[model samples]
Structures are given as structure tokens and as C-alpha cells.
Target: MSRSFVKMNGLGNDFVVVEARGAPFRPTPEEVRAIADRESGIGCDQLIAIEPTANADAFMRIWNADGSEVSACGNATRCVGWLLMQAKGDGRATIETLAGLLTTWAAGPRAVTVDMGAPGLGWRDIPMAEDMDTRGVELQVGPIDAPHLHTPGCVSMGNPHVVFFVANAELAPVREVGPMIEHHLLFPEGVNVGFCEVREPDRIRLRVWERGAGETKACGTGACAAVVAASRRGLAKRRATVTLDGGDLKIDWREDDGHVLMSGPVAVEFTGVLP
Candidate 1:
């Protein structure tokens, strides 16, 4: 049999959005892994599935390269918005995921805007072992001064995240410290970790190590989580620009509606049939 997939990317974090709505086959974890493999398959950071939705545009499911299903993906969600917009010939998209229903709009020029819904701030939401304050939880990884970085603000952007507001962005030892903290004992389910530096009240620098996906070029939910962590700590405003290693994304956690809005561009790299 044959399979069809679309190559898509939000910022630089890319995915293979497979529309298996009416197809004969649903991709197995092994198949998804093959498709995400750089040496064998299509080579994407993640794989997305657009399935049926009872009352929404479609169901957006995210699978990491390792074949683990993830709760949410902001950039891939925008890519879904772009694809669905083209299908309906309109400029809006509403997608259902494990997180919830998300509303999206097309911004001018290459960007699409998505209402990612409000973040869930709690130990259980972030799925920590115990209940700690969301603003700043006591989490010590390695040491103190030369420590392996600690005290992260835990939040859930449909999935779990731990954001560390640091004094430096580039020198924070993300590659070393991130993997350790991600699998720390407190986060029994494992967690996506973000290192953030507040450049301004409306701008921040972010680097992320995602659960099941490692350190990708970019991450939308990580950016949203960083913004929320900063906002809760009074370090940043609700509306802020988050600069990732791949590119920049605008996030607005609306005060009135309590929805987190993310704006970024998605690129369709290529498409092909699966054997």
C-alpha cells in the first residue's frame, strides 16, 4: 500500500503531517519512527496526524521521532491551521488535540496565529510528584553555584513543562543540564525543560529540551510555557516575543479570555508516498 504525508514546519521545528482521515492504514509507532528517521525515512522532528473531530476542524495528534505520542505541539498546530485553511479556502482553523480545541487564524505574510488555550499551572497539571507553587518550585538538580541549574517554574501547555528563568541564555549549559533535569525524580512522567533569559518585559530568549524529542531546533509549546512561567513570576508581560534557536514567535496570554495566542510561520518542505 501507499501513504501520503505533507512536510510542514513551524519556525524551524518541522514535522510530517499525515492525513490519515480516510486512509486504509494508520501509522504504527515503528512506521512513525521510520518516517521520522533522518537516515531512512522522511526525516522530520515529529510526525502529526489529522484525524476526525466531532465538532472541531480535525484532531491533531503529535508523535515524536522516538514514536512517543505527545500532548501538544504549537507550531505543528499552526501548520495544521494552514493546511485546513487551504482546504476550506478560508483563513481560520480549529483543531482538537489531547489538550483541547484550539482556534487559529492566518496572519499576514507567512504566519498563522493560534489560540493555544490557557496554561495549566499546578503540580499535578505539570504532573510533579507533590504540589508546589507554580511560580517557583524548589528543584535542585546537581549543585548550587556550579550547580546543574534548578528551581524551575512548572506549567502544563496541554503537556508538562519545567521552565528555568536564568541569568544567561547562551551559557546556561542546556545540553548538559537539560537532559538531567528532564528525567529528574520529581517529574515522574518525565518533562520538557526550558531555559529562559528575560531580555525585556516583552521579549525573552528560550532554549528547550523536549521530552521524547530531545533538543530540537525549535518548540512552540516550550515558548508558550516559557512565557507563562515568566508571567507568573512577574518577570514578563502576558504578551511577549520568545526567541528560540530556530526563530522568533509571538505569544499573547490574553487577560480577558485566558487563551495563549501563538504566532509563527510554517514551511511545507516536501511530500512523498510511503511504501
Candidate 2:
């Protein structure tokens, strides 16, 4: 049977949103890959399935373009929250995922804010192969005498992330080093790689290599994790604007609540029925 889907994006990180609230819509791994194929199918960075939930408005299932099922995706959450809020004619919505429950609200016109919960800083939380200092994990790239990126901060905003403080985000070798660190033996479960350049205490430039999706135009959780990593390393403030390749995102690591709030605009690219 054919199913209707909405193509949405936060910044330029796109998704194929399938609402499976009324019926089951479980696609095989190959189907997911096909749906995410840019050349032949309805391409998207991730395929999101919105299913009925008892605790929250919906349960979001995330599948990467490579067909790997992941626990969390912040950009997809904002897009889903916007859709739910539009349907309910309200500004607030709750979404549940393997990461946990996320509360979101309409920040402004076509913009949404999501409380991404507290960041996990423990070595066990990042779940490295063995215990290590998460603030600046022992990892390096390039030659030992002149390393390109080293001593990255490790944190988990629902998923594992390793952020390198670079001098220029544009110069960072995302394609070459990203995959090398993503499949690094230390991460074990694989990890998202972020190259962050702190422009000021309040602004940051970032680029991300997502675990299964390669380098997307933007990554919401990656933005949040970048800010958190910067703050932890004392390079930036608790709250800052993360400038991604596609656009900017306002990220606030709230001091009182210990929750990370991410605000950004969402867009509906198009809608169609899956063939």
C-alpha cells in the first residue's frame, strides 16, 4: 500500500516523515536505503516514522540514509514538533524517542525550540571502549609531531559525539577525518564527529559528520553538542549561536535546569506518496 509522507528540513538537514499512527509502517533496511537514495527515490538525510504513543504526542523512529536505526535526531524532532503543533493548533508538543522524552514549542514563525535534555559527560555515557576523560579524550589525527585535530571533547546528547576545537571550520577535513574517527575503535558504537570553530563566546561555526548519514548540511544535536563541548572546555559560554553550513541555530545550555534548548527554523520541502 502507498503511504503519504512529508518532506521537511531544519536548516538544510532534511527528512522523509512518515506518520504511522493509525497503522504500522515498518520498512525493511533496503526500503529505507531506497527511500533515502537521492538519485532514484525520495531522498532525505533520515527517514522518520511517527507512531502512536501513550506518554507523548508521538514516538519518533529514526533511520539514517544508510539504513541504520538510531536513537535520536534533534532536527527531525523539531520538524515533527512543528507538524504536531500545527495539527493541534497549539505551540507546544511532546515527542518520545529512544533517547528520552523531548518537550518542544513554537519559538517563532516556522521556528521551534526543543529541550534536548541534559548532556551526558561521563566516559560510560559516551560509552567509550574504556574509561577516559570525556572533557578531552585521547584522540588525535594527522602526524603526531603536527596533529591536525587532537584532544577532542566527548559527550552524548542522546548519542555519542566527539568535538574537535579547530581554528577554522572550513579548513577542517570533514570527509577524510570524520569517517576515520567515526569508525575509530575507541568509540565502539560509532560516533558523530564535529569540527567546531569558536568565533566568540556567544558564536560558533560548526561542521558535522553524522555516524551513518555522512556530512549533512546541518545537524541539530550536533549543534547542541558543540555548544556543550565548547562550554565544558571553557572555550564558549553556556549559550551560543551555532552557525552551520545551511543556517544558524540558537543553543542554550540552561544553567538552572541543566537542559539544552535548541531553537531553529523548519521548512516543509514537499509532500508525496511513497511508491
Candidate 3:
């Protein structure tokens, strides 16, 4: 038996999207790991399984390269939106995930705009282990060059995130503190850590170390979370261009809708059969 798959990327955050609606078999953790293995398999930052849903849009599942089932993935959502648009000839769309129904729209050339719902900013909502005032978030990481790194703004973009404001994101010890903060006692569920530097009122530079998945070219939710965090900090405005390693994402936190709209490019890399 074989399954068809599409390899796509949103700002180089690659994904292998498998449409398993009519398929009889689901991918195992090991199999998902293999598919995301660049050396041995299809190669991707993550693997997305698209299954049928009842009350909502298509069911979307995320798997990390290590084969762990994750809660949410934003770039993959855009990639899947592109894949579905090509397959179903779409103008607008929605997807069901463990989080909730995610809405997407056809926008810009090679770009899909996703309404990533609202940012979840609560002590228990972000699902942090202990009780802390989310209105003014706090954390305890080892040594940071700056003291403020410990008290980053926290939010959940379907997945957990901790956005730290720095003078220069590149200078921050992403590889060092990222792992430490990701596995910190506060976030029992783990989290994607982002270092953000405000370039302007409408621009920010971010470098992310994703949870489950390590450093990648870009992270859509991370970008959104960063913008929201910056907005809360009075650094960046409601709309900001988040510059990631791969490219820029236009994030607009609509004043009326209250949805974080992520706009970015999606590119088809290749397609193959799953053996």
C-alpha cells in the first residue's frame, strides 16, 4: 500500500503534508519520524496528516521530526492551505486541529493568510504548571546577559510560546537558553522559545527555537506570538512585519476581529509516494 504526499514550505519551514482522508492506515510515530528525516526519508521540519472532520474543516495533525505528536503548527497550516487550494480550487478555507478550527484565506502571490485565532494568555490557559499572573508573565532561566529575559510575555498560539524582547535577537543565546527555557519547570508542556528585537513600531526580528522541533528557518505561530508579546510590551504596533531567518511574515492583529492574521508565502518543493 502507498500514500501520496506533498512537500511544501512556508518561508522554508518545510512540511510533508499527507492527505489521509481516504487512506486506511495512519502513520506511526517512527514512520512520521522517518518521513521527516532529511537523510533517509521525505525530509521536512514537520509532517502534517490531513483527515476528515465532522463539525469543522479537515482535521490536521502535527508530528515533529522526532515523531512526537504535537498540538499546533502554523506554517504547516499555510502549506496545507496551499495544498488544499490546489486540490480543491479554493478561495477561503478552514482546518480542524487539536486546538480548534483554524481559518485560512487565499491572499497574495504564493501567500496564504491565516486567522490564527486569539492568543491564549492565562496562567492555566497557557497551561503553565504553576500559578502565575499571565498579565505580567515571569520565568526562571539560568543566566541571561540581560535580567529581563526571565520575565518574557507568554502566550499560546494553539501551542505554547515564550517571547523574550532583546536588543538583538542574534546576540541572544538562543541555542543556549532556548533549551533551558523550553524544558523549564514552569512549562510542563514545553514551549517554543523566541527572541525578539523590535526594529520599528511595525517591524521586529525574531529567532525561534521551536518546541519538539528545534531551530528552523521560520515559525508562523512563533512570529504571531512574538508580535502579540511585543504589542503588549508597547514595543511593536498592532501590525508588524516579523523577520525570521527564512523571510518576513506580515502579521496583522485586527482591531475588530481580534484574530492574528499571518500572511506569508508558500512554495511547493516536490511530491512523492509513501512506501
Who wins the TM-score comparison? 2
Report the lDDT tens digits of candidate 3 across residue range 1-275: 77888889999999988888896446788888888888888888898889988855588888988788888889999987777776677777788888889888889768899889988988777779888765456665555565647678888999999888889888988888888888888888888999999999999999999887788899999999998888987888999999999999999988896789999999999889886
- Model 2, position 176, has a per-residue lDDT of 96
Q: Which stretches of candidate 3 lie over 4 Å from their true place?
A: 140-148
Model 1 global lDDT (CA atoms, 0 to 1): 0.87
Relative to the true structure, candidate 2 reaches a TM of 0.99
**Comparison by lDDT, 1 against 2, better one:** 2
**lDDT of candidate 1 over 1-275, digit per residue (tens):** 56688988887898988887885346688988888898888888888989987879899888988888887998899999999998998889899998889998899656899998889897888898987897899886665766556677988999889998789888877888788888888899889999999999999999998887788889999999999999988999999999998999999999997888999887888888765
Model 2, span 95-195: residue lDDT tens: 99999999999999899999999999999998799999999988999899998889999989999999999999999999999999999999989999999
User: Between prediction 2 and prediction 3, which has the larger lDDT?
Assistant: 2
- Evaluated against the true structure, the overall lDDT of model 3 is 0.86
TM-score order, best first, reads 2, 1, 3
Q: List the residue pairs that clash in candidate 3.
A: none
Give the runs in model 2 whose Cα sits over 4 Å from its true position. none
